[model samples]
Target: METKRFYQQRLDEWVEESRKQAYKGRVAEYIPGLAAAPQHALGIALWGTDGQFFQSGDTDLHFTMQSISKVFSLLLALMDSGEKSVFQKVGMEPTGDDFNSILKLELVDPGKPFNPFINAGAIVIASLIQGDGPDEKSERLLQFIRHLAHDNRLDYNEAVYESERETAHRNRSIAYYLKDNGVLEDDVEETLEVYFRQCSIVVNCKQLAHMALVLASDGVDPVTKQQVIPRRYVQIAKSFMVTCGMYNASGEFAIEVGLPAKSGVSGGILSVVPGKWGIGIIGPALNSKGNSVAGVQLLRHLSQDWDWSIF
Candidate 1:
């Protein structure tokens, strides 16, 4: 009880510290759809293993899962196809480029993407899910996410999807190239539709915190006392989260925060505590690498103070 009370104190202090950082990061503007986000938007939330929730700031804003969804989709693919089959399509190593780069894919000589976190790799992995159709597969995937977070109301961010789709000319090019080279299965357009839709699914910090909580608990929903995802799948997901979840800054983040984290342009960060906790953060302001500016700072502070890194 003392420890729980102490954590609550720290959470309040941390939330206070974060509001001061509101203007330190710029809101993502490259995509016209996300450019207009309220610059100071911020939120922090944590779900303990005991079914207690700790949340603060703008906790209700619906933001897309963005890159964070890569972890779940990758887990689903691994569960469906097993390790060897999925890894053969995409690698398990990190690429030191931007997440959506076509440059490294070409340099790798038509080989699979460096890891499942990058857009090229995620798109390929999305193609490999054993789905009857893109929509059906997406529906199933959303249902899975809803169950994990225990939030049935979490739904697609249609405006973000349309915005991403309209601006996804680069993703289309990558998908077509992979199709021509035989890296992607199913139809290129179909795969991209699924990929974009997955990216567009939106949730608040508390929901994602619960999702991360399950992963941290090794695929069991700590609050519900149910096996939500396979342990094997969680292992694979956590491994990638440490190595490739942070885009190019992953190595540094892994060293600093020491947790498996996934960041997105939407300024949402989802992290696994690997048998401990699941932390979710959101701040619309982004650093140059497309991470939540204040969120990253907050995690780094907490990880260092609490020694939460998996390494």
Candidate 2:
């Protein structure tokens, strides 16, 4: 068989294995909505410049963007405020705290939330979206993300939005603290609304993967041939991914996988291979860190098999 045939063959095999692996993990239980997801649900999808995608299992299930939205939220802030201006509000360091933890703001010197990937930092990023209110800001973010993914139909799932709103007391606390610290500009409730809305934007693996693919290709969808975001911005985002994408386990994952990736509580993992490929894996089962369990295994297997280690 030819090389292309062999790659296709392996891709099929991995999808099957991932489905079986999904059952071994447990659905994220801490979040009310997430805990209700089918524990056995599993999906893996891939999108590349070739304009072809291979997906398997329950690939159509809609899930919250959850933490994965932080990636674009950070980029939008950087794009609107410039990197230097954005960093003045949030630090690039990784903290080992739980994603929604506000303890670090007081524990650490300079008291900046650790990296844009964390909840506290992500809230600050939301305030920099350059709009008058939550609705305008969220629409701006939605438009940017839709363009990046080359999908105009993308929109928020109101159920997930309301679900998060009702359950986001912790996130609201973080947002208010950022405001108190002078890191957030928008009203606390309004900023939390935007943050919750961003997290509620639903996407499947194909949409999510293509979103990552745009970043992988330096903010250009090769198929669309449009430069959705500046190449330099993608570089910076990927840099942060390597340094801080995986929450508290970022260092461990970095040492093992060597790729800049982001994972969400919705069992979505957006893994990027800069200039080559972007992978999206969604399996609701989560570990202690709120990362998708089977999703991690799937990406780790793919990265190793494809030799996608970026380090």
Pairs with backbone N, CA or C atoms under 3 Å apart (clashes), candidate 2: none
TM-score winner: 1
The models' CA-based lDDT, in order, is: 0.85, 0.81
Tens-digit lDDT string for candidate 2 (114-225):
7888888888889888997889999999998787767898899887778788978888877777777777767899888898899888788888888888888898868768
Q: How many residue pairs clash per model?
A: 1, 0
TM-score of each: 0.96, 0.94
State the lDDT of candidate 1 residue by residue for 18-110, as single tens digits. 757868788877667788788787788888776667787878887889888888888888877888999888988888899888987788757
TM-score of 1: 0.96
Task: Give candidate 1 misplaced runs (Cα > 4 Å).
Answer: none
What residue pairs clash in candidate 1, if any at all? 258-309
- RMSD (Cα, Å) for all candidates, in order, is 1.5, 1.7
Task: Give lDDT: candidate 2, residue 154.
Answer: 86
